[model samples]
Target: MDSRSLPNSSKSSKSSRAEVSVKRSPVEPRVSTLLDVISISMGETG
Candidate 1:
């Protein structure tokens, strides 16, 4: 029981970590693009 539970907990933790990373990546690109565009516009104006 202990052995099985240990592996299961590890798998769940890894999956949760992967899911969080996947969720974060989509938002990062959008925020990054917005910052890039704003910088470019400021550069042109300045």
Candidate 2:
């Protein structure tokens, strides 16, 4: 029981971590681009 539970827990944790990273991967670039655009616009206006 302990051995089975150990692998299961590890697999779940790894999958959850991978999912979080994958979700953030695309979002981070979008947010960075938005910030860059905002900064550029402000610079031009200023």
Candidate 3:
């Protein structure tokens, strides 16, 4: 059960990251960097 759930969680995280990348593409570089940091922190905690 743990092995199965690990891949599923990673998959969902990838999808969410992709969506965020697309939405932030046109935004400022500084904002994008900030978002990247936030996402990384969230990933580590979660």
Candidate 4:
């Protein structure tokens, strides 16, 4: 993992306050990739 891994992971799973409208952004592609990695990490740990 690198420096970005932390912030991006946190941002994606942080809260539902802005979650709805947040998906309309163009950055969703990259963010989704990061979320995938986070999901794998969570699965492995659990």
Between candidates 2 and 3, the one scoring higher on TM-score is 2
Candidates 1 and 4 compared: the better one by lDDT is: 1
lDDT of 1 by residue, 1-46 (tens): 6888999999999999999999999999999999999999999999
lDDT of 3 at 33: 89
Tens digits of per-residue lDDT, candidate 2, 13-41, equal 99999999999999999999999999999
Model 1 lDDT, full chain set:
0.97
Error of 3 at 36 (Å): 22
TM-score for all models, in order of appearance: 0.60, 0.63, 0.55, 0.42
Model 4 ranges off by over 4 Å: 1-26
Q: Is candidate 1 or candidate 2 better by TM-score?
A: 2
Q: What is candidate 3's TM-score against the reference? A: 0.55
| Regions more than 4 Å wrong, model 2 | 1-10
Error of 1 at 44 (Å): 1.9
Model 4, position 13, has a per-residue lDDT of: 71
Model 1: per-residue Cα lDDT at residue 28: 100
Candidate 4 local accuracy as lDDT? Answer: 0.82
Clashing pairs in 4: none
- Give the per-residue lDDT of model 4 (tens digit) for 1-46: 6998998888877765477557657688889999999999999999
lDDT of each: 0.97, 0.97, 0.93, 0.82
